[model samples]
Target: MNNISSISNPIRAPRAAFLGSNLHHHHHRLTILPRRPNVVVCSSSVSTPTSPSLSVAQEANRIGSLSQVSGVLGCQWGDEGKGKLVDILAHHFDIVARCQNEREAVKLFHEIKGATPNHVTYTTLIDGYCTINDLEEALRLCKVMEAKGLYPGVVTYNSILRKLCEEGRIRDANKLLHEMSERKVVPDNGGANAGHTIYNAEGKKFALHLVPSGILNEDTLCVIGNGVVVHLPGLFEEIDGLESNGVSCEGRILVSDRAHLLFDFHQEVDGLREFELAKSFIGTTKRGIGPCYSSKVIRNGIRVGDLRHMDTFPQKLDVLLLDAASRFQGFNYGTEMLREEVEKYKRYAERLEPFIADTVHVMNDAILENKKILVEGGQATMLDIDFGTYPFVTSSSPSAGGICTGLGIAPRVVGDLIGVVKAYTTRVGSGPFPTEILGQGGDLLRFAGQEFGTTTGRPRRCGWLDIVALKYSCQINGFSSLNLTKLDVLSDLPEIRLGVSYKHINGTPIKSFPADLRLLEQLKASGISYEVLPGWKSDISSIRNYADLPLAARTYVERIEELCGVPVHYIGIGPGRDALIVK
Candidate 1:
């Protein structure tokens, strides 16, 4: 004799007996005692030779009763024999079709005899676990399903991925995405201070500041790595612009949770600091990169992950705002201001939920999984804070070393470092440029190369290629090859010059780039040594192969390779994507 259990609802029925027993061959009848109108009975049973069972029509009627049950189950009654009900249902249905508020039902479903759970059954339980925010159990079910030779499909993976991302468990989500065979990540190491201009296949130009160039590719994942200081408004503006231009950016972009947030107040502080310096100001884009990095180094900066906890976000943001307010009198900070900023960030936090990720884990995991990754460095080595000319440098490291620190990948994983240099040199702001052309000569090169800042729209100071700086940069970055761009810019010139060496005011040869700004000034004033080469004079932009280049152009390219000791592997003749020549 099988024992039937009593289900008691505290609010409705004092005692309700749920009765079901074997009636005839492979048939059973269910009867509810006390006849409570609100009482819902959902059950299933399979027949053995000696055990109780339900007929096909009776089982259909019982399963149809599920429509009367609420979509979300609240198992309020204590010890309602949910495990027994799940066990009874497991053998007859593909999906258990009920979410009991306890894990015992799910565990029992797995242990039931002759109850083989398929992908749908596992996915249903996993979705239920995710709904309860029990991700551990959900992941365990995934492993169990895989162990039983049932591969979890996109639905199963999406349930877990959504929960992990919502909880800001980006590393776990990234690992799961890798398991789903979604690979390829492009990481940006620099801030908005540097800009990259890329032309697509159709000659459509994109001016990218905070975003990586890989955004054009649909399959690539673009990561604004930890070394970057993100300006949320600017980042969204870029995304909105891209989306408007038919580029879908929903899942392809990710901002590192560890990256520092750049507030509008930081931009205000940047202008104030630049004003104080007056003429000696670092020719920054006034994008607040320096001030934001200052806050990060000083340990008072807020991170992207801080957006997740809005309860404490106000306090953390207040600290940053107050710090800026105290330093710059022009900076305005008040309770009203804080309130407004908090409200604005509340909206930003909601919008940024999908883009925030643990890029450190994403990058390292990509490396470990042997997935191809591209690390796009923003600023040139000449603008690097440590190696570049002091006082005129950007706030972050733009060298190869920045790759490891910025993306949180091991140094051993970094492959061929390609150094991209223009055939002619250009500088945007105030810097000790040894090879700068001061007169109409620079004006000619400026017009020829279209030398203008992509972000600031300022005319870049034009000059001859500085081999001294190139060699120094090559040594520092350990570049395996070089990409010489804009070779077509020198087509009209009768001759081209390379700043081969530097000399002192006292007629002595300077061995390497001088760290002393005063010495740099002296060398620039005294005129550097130049090696003049014959120009190609012909239009090389139409040339597709390296061998197709003119004799003079080949000579010029070979001379640069001989000087820098790095072979030129790629040559960019024009601004289009198809304009590049591979050697």
Candidate 2:
């Protein structure tokens, strides 16, 4: 096979004439005709001409004329009769080339051949688009290739990276590199507690909890890594829902065998734990994520792999149930409950068998194979257990470190980390929101942004963009770039505010996001400092290019970049994928 990289620019043939006369008992003639300005036609009388006496220039002109005729014929007719023509011309031509600029070429090829375009076709087209410096179209083709269950190889990614680098879009190039290197493992630290709302091309919303956002791309393997806690029933429900909506899940979704199982009892324990705290209840999704992790840490947890051995499953269940029962007086445990739970789990185990996998090996194997993995995080950094506000945070680490522990991947392989932040700040549950906009102001943002919890459906506390918190998140994650989402949410407001910093009640500046709950609560009450900027006050939802956005909107985006020291590469003007402005 000829390498596309070695293919030169389009060869232009000179307009020439070919003439032949009748010879040896037959009247034969060759004619050269011009069909259009750039098209040429040639007709030969002789079946096979042996012209040893012809000059080299004349021979070259004859061959070029024939090639031009073949190109014209190929363009005039569809794939019909193209094969016979190719076979006949195969001996004369060194290479057969097709126009890559034809947008419907691939679709036509598929329709005519009844076969999908192979990797070479996709890569060649992508490279061709890149050569012409149409990077946007190149990227779109890449996505389309992936959507058809074809993964882009190294050559394909390199072509895009090279084009991006040539254009001085280093951040975007780095982002592509990160996607090329990382294997996205949605770790054990998060379960179905967090939710990501994604909008499809048709404007249909998918509320994903357990499944990664990568599910939208057909070729992407969504792995629930070892660090994640799996709630099998919830996982299957999500799978069924997706499949019902025309998305396939069978071979695409993988649940790590080593991931601990979050049972219904774990959720009961979680609620009981919260009830015990009463007035000081930590705002949890009551999804049993914390209790499941607690079981894992305590060494009494049941992993997804345990379901394979049904014989000892009952014994393991008894131990877990007993542990929960002993802790809470309100908890009731009996033989009937155990028997019922065991029967239910048996069904769950049978259904979950196909999805279970040793993800550690899968991830490592993919890395070795040079497959691009995109890690999709469940929660924000501020909601991390170790790094986030104490007691108020979720049980797991939702920060950069979680990618390693959760996915069983080496830290060195983790590439560019892009933080997705809203145009304004909003928190679902209880925590110190230093930049909170209270009363009517908060209501305006809340209703405008539709700041409701995806998992819990609770009203989120809306506020101005908190630069202090964002900078701290950047510092923690070392994000290469930031994706500013929901910028269109602020279109209705006359002015927008960014919480620039925090201060003490007595006028001292708080430099960083403090971990102390007391200090955070104090700051939340009256210590936030704000920098107000003018809003665009016009709808920007239809914008796709960053340059087309209003000056005020661009200023708002750039100001955030200045404050956080991270480039805002992706600006989400609206919910749909097409609404994102690549800055």
In order, the Cα lDDT scores of the candidates are: 0.62, 0.61
lDDT of 2: 0.61
TM-score of each: 0.66, 0.66
In model 1, the clashing pairs are: none
Q: Single out the weakest 10-residue window by summed lDDT for candidate 1.
A: 98-107
Write down the RMSD of candidate 1 (Cα, Å): 33.5
Q: For this target, which candidate reaches the highest lDDT against the unseen true structure?
A: 1
Q: Which stretches in model 1 have alpha-carbon errors above 4 Å?
A: 1-194, 279-284
Residue pairs with backbone overlap in model 2: 184-375, 187-227, 187-228, 188-227, 188-228, 189-227
What overall lDDT, based on C-alpha atoms, would model 1 receive against the true structure? Answer: 0.62
- lDDT tens digits, residues 115-174, model 2? 234444565556546654568978998999999877775656767877898999999987
Error of 2 at 312 (Å): 1.3
What's the distance in Å from true for residue 247, model 1? 1.2
Q: Ten residues in a row with the worst lDDT in model 2?
A: 99-108
| Clash number by candidate, in order | 0, 6
lDDT of 1 by residue, 381-486 (tens): 7766788776566677667777777777777766666677888787654456667776567868887886644433334667788888889988888887677778
